[model samples]
Target: MSLADLEPNSLHVVLHVRSHPPKANDFHWGLYLHRDFEAGGTKYHLKGADKRWLADHGTTRGVFKSFLLIGLCQVARIPSGLMKDVDAMFRTYDHQLNEMPGLTCRTWVFRVLELLQKPHSGQVLLECNDLTSLEYELLSWGNANALAAADCQQPRPTHRSDLCGL
Candidate 1:
């Protein structure tokens, strides 16, 4: 599903590769943090052992953190629950980040709707098999409706003359 499906105030933290040029249109994976912890906090600390630990797990961790910085700058607001989900997602992927020695990470917030309008061109779509059947159905319906509306013509505005300048 497109990032636009996220709620209006949903917050997303993003990061991108510094070596790559930014794009106008793209979808990037974002980490949604809990609202209570949305503001800046104690800095994330990764050292030699931690880095080695992550590397031992896989490559995705480092990739995820690098991208978090970019998404965070684009987010405006985020729902509390979605934020929690993001934090949990990060923890789930922490192993990947721990492997990168001397790598840096940053964070920011923006309106979910706004970010979706200008997503990173290099972003990747993640498959969410965790969604319930009903949730999936609803998402499908919403996407279909949005597509149909985008293709439809707008109704013309009608003119009226009740009280002309006196």
Candidate 2:
């Protein structure tokens, strides 16, 4: 279904998983998403929760794309709770990665988190095996374009200082 089919208040959850073992110096990570709530707050149900293992060098770029698509369908803010959820997910998967010890998995977690938090400004390049350059570019470009357009529509301050004839 197209993004238009989604509910106006619907949220998108993107989970990024790493596959390889961790190195002597690396951290494992993951990503998740949820709907933004009003001041009253909202609840998320994890029904039918399941886990899927990713092969070596899996890209979390898809999650970014999904968020963009959902955002495009309807304008919405990222909920505070959703950010907490993403952090918690990272912690959990980090622990899991520690047990198995995959270098690739350990490294990509922070990269994915960085992308989710700040797509365009993220220091981590999506060109690495962990993420697809195409998907990363698409999501980053989409977000940048949307933000630029929105900024253009906003009113700029025209009042100048020294109006009192100093």
Per-model lDDT = 0.29, 0.29
Error of 1 at 166 (Å): 45
Per-residue lDDT of 1-166 in model 2, one digit per residue for the tens?
A: 3322333233232222111221221212222232322221222112111232342222232223422121221112343435444434334443343334343432444344344443333322122232343234324433434432333322211111111111
Candidate 1 lDDT, 1-166, residue by residue in tens: 2223333333333322222333322223233421222333211222233245321112122322332223222223433434443343334435556544443332111122223333233331222222233233323333333322233322211111111110
Question: What's the distance in Å from true for residue 119, model 1?
Answer: 24
Worst 10 residues of 2 by lDDT: 157-166
Model 1 TM-score (2 dp): 0.24
Candidate with maximal TM-score? 1
